[model samples]
Target: MTSQRAVERGASVLIDAGSLTRCRHRLYLDTAYSALLRQEPENPGVRQRREAARAQREDIRSRLSETLDGWTEIEAPDARTASELTMAACRRRVPWIWNAVLPIERTTGRRGRSEILMLDPVDGGYIPIIVVNHKVTDPGRGARTSRLTEWAPAVDETRKVRSQLRDQLRLAHLYRMLDFEGIASPNAHGGAIGYRAECILVHDLTTVFDEYDARFLDRLSVARGESFTVPSQVSECRSCPWWTDCRPQLVANRDVSLVASGMRADALREQGVSTIDELADFSGPEPDNWPFGSFTDAVAAATAWRAGVPLLRRTDEVTVHRADVEVDVDMESYQEHGAYMWGTLLTEKGGPPAQYRGFVTWDPLPTVDEGRSFAEFWAWLMGKRADAAARGKTFAAYCYSRAAEDKWLLDSARRFGDISGVPTEAEIREFIDSEQWVDIYQAVSDQFICPNGKGLKKIAPVAGFEWRDAEAGGEASMGWYREAVGYDAEPDTTQRERLLVYNEDDVRATKVLREWMSDRAEIEIPTLESLRSAV
Candidate 1:
């Protein structure tokens, strides 16, 4: 049987799931196609499978004829003999023998290069085993291509690398039992006569029946049109390329079982049940006779299942105090001189603080908010301070050694400070040094934060707050934002909306983080002292 149009397909399905049924047929196809893709392309699995399958086919053929005197299969003894034997088998009229052989020459074209070879039963027709490595899909199956699909000709370089593998196979004298479809091109040179054949059946004797398991061999031999029942064990599917389609069907039909206990647990978890709700009966803390480790995990999984949800927990609660103040705080301003001045005194009354708050200016040029200038920002700070005083609230801000928040506020102050009578840059620097700001990052690293690097993204999540985006604009990078602002050109209204959305998201995230910090202190009270003392 000569096959001229061979095809290959790629997919991302994992071998573990019951969904592998779809991959089984593709696996067999891939095994053959992979031969066309290798550098010295020889797929031991494909060759072995095809040989074993051909053996079964020949067994059936011999049994059908009572006059058959003898039959023999010669394993590839050597290069010359293997090639000669294979060529003889293809040309024989009565005595049919299947051999895997590689063609001597290759022709290249737009579609892809094709390797021509003769196959068994070549008596009346040219059983050309034409090999092609290109992308194709089974439209009848309604299967769409994935990222694995690409423009065929665009990958000529990659194709050449793979074709070299065929060159090595030609020298190995291991080319038999391999046949493919015809080769065609989009350009000048038309295509060659294509060889067509029945589906390529692959079987691994070591797998279908193991070293000591031969009882099934008899059934496999005589069974003409029936699919012999193989072990439904998933391990059988896993190293097997056809695992995708065959394994799932086997499992659903109760033909296969996960023998590995750990694998069973994973399979169950994947099914969205981590508990005993459906698997076992439980009254309280634990279930009796739980098969896997940690009945607690199983119980959680079961609960999630009944609730129609995933078994994983996402949030942990935390708390903080209102009195962790340690430093003074104020906003800074800047002039064209590049010097800065701290102007808006927002935290002069409180203890040396651990953090600071600064107003971030949103550029709304061509539609500027006159009252929203830097000076207005300073006036707003004083207004907030006065309002807090009426309620007996002292503005105490805390800043770490790096003074990240302070630096931003300082810049803001100088840029928009009430220059009429604001403190000079030198005086502002003096007040900053007097605050004795602590460096939480250093404190934690040098025995702080309980053995973890000090990043707010990490800490905040552990404290029950996740980094979330409320809008797509929030996810835009600095480069994207700059583009919206037309960094080098006139701004558009659409860009203004994007910047507004981004600024709004920043403020919202900051507020959420502050609230999370307070909540964390309450939840982790037991560990609060350890965390602080560690630093």
Candidate 2:
């Protein structure tokens, strides 16, 4: 529900409580465009994607209704508001109260409030007003708690206490009477109970309410065009409609933000260093308040961006253990069906080039069967390790990150393996704890700072490796999986082949990164401990 205070205080467009709780600039721009132009200022593709997402949300809501029964739905007084709020309530499985203007008098001349209050029934006719929001994926525990703290006060103030008790009712007291709940899908597991629910009570609700009040006032002015600027976040900008218009200017001027990310760019700009050229050529003593803790580190990053090469900041931090027999591993999984393929590229000490292998599930299966497929992959990996041992060569399985690959290995073993299986918990843990399972991404990040990005797709190209499929990406591969597995239609053999090629490239990229780092021994920087001591 939107804050009634926000509406009456002259907000041009009402933002949902969930969205307003994060990224004020995004809300301001969206609101300003909608208010001034009467439509969203988005490109066709963005608009189409938004529409598709909305449809998916609606589908989830419909499915939720089928699962959750016997909940009464309350509609708004106005037809349009009622329709929207009703759908929202149905999806959230809470009773929605619309046209529920705050008791406070209108202060900023706006006539109507579009906020909807939801009520959750308790035993013996007790109903606590709840603020509900839905997310397609896990918003994380910290974020959910922050959202509850932000929304509680507004909900508390909307409470209708008796006239006699009104004098004793403070915002804090009201906040305690209300509740907040978020429904979120933790993973891409497409099932009825895949969505998890989290509820929280705000202890510092009054303080947060005051802060939110002031922040909303400032945002309202921006929404009305007092001031506006495009967000400098590169990730956000890439998907933004104005990116094409803004990118050329940023490039031509060598915007510092291109080299430095997050608040560091702003910090640099504040110091009158606003371009990569200026930063690279900077000769003055270190600024008194360097954002990166040390001037040399900042300069190293700038130099790397300017020269278009990875900057190894600390030689000793580069702890990637090279092996005579290395296996670069990458996995492709449809979250809906669990992990289905484990691809590996094997390289020997004097081998010609990396040899590719894939362990794939060729048929749709139950969760148990999926686990069995993973077990097979594990057996193959162990066989490779055994062959390397027989040849008297050290073997290591290298992956970009340990989080996913490691988790899958352990989880699959727990789900499918016998106590003595190749990927038993004990075996996987020993492998990971030893030098046998190398996380190249962690090693790269610990040693070098790549201004372009740290992603395999970004790093591999600079190391002279390229994917054959230009459209190969994590999301694109997921789409390819759907097509290949015939999730919605007949299986496409071409798509399956493309998926394998994509997987192969991913594993090969890790091998390429490993070799590239190994060859740069001469360029290694000081050890991290020494660098810290010097700083």
Most accurate candidate by lDDT: 2
**Candidate 1's residue-wise lDDT over 386-413, tens digit each?**
5666766643333323454445445434
Q: Score residue 91 of candidate 2 by CA lDDT.
A: 58
Q: Name the lDDT of candidate 2.
A: 0.57
Candidate 1 accuracy as TM-score = 0.28
Work out the TM-score per prediction. Answer: 0.28, 0.67
Global lDDT of each candidate: 0.33, 0.57
Assess candidate 1 and give its lDDT.
Answer: 0.33
Residue lDDT tens for model 2, 1-535: 2466555435444333333233445556566555643543555444434444444434434543455444444445765565455446535555533333332212331222222233433221112222222222232232212121122222232222112111112222222222121221111111011112222222224334565445545655655555555445455665555556567877877787787755677777778998887887777877765566456666666776666555445554344679888899998765434578899898888887778988887565324566666777777888989999998988999999778887677767766775334366898888788878889888877776666777888777766899999888875676677678776589988998998999998998888778877775435443434433554
User: Which ranges in model 2 have alpha carbons more than 4 Å from their true place?
Assistant: 1-11, 17-69, 73-218, 270-272, 281-296, 307-320, 335-337, 351-353, 362-368, 414-422, 520-535
**In model 1, which regions exceed 4 Å deviation?**
1-372, 397-402, 411-423, 426-452, 467-477, 492-535
lDDT of 1 at 370: 19
Residue 225, model 1, lDDT: 14
Which has the greatest TM-score?
2
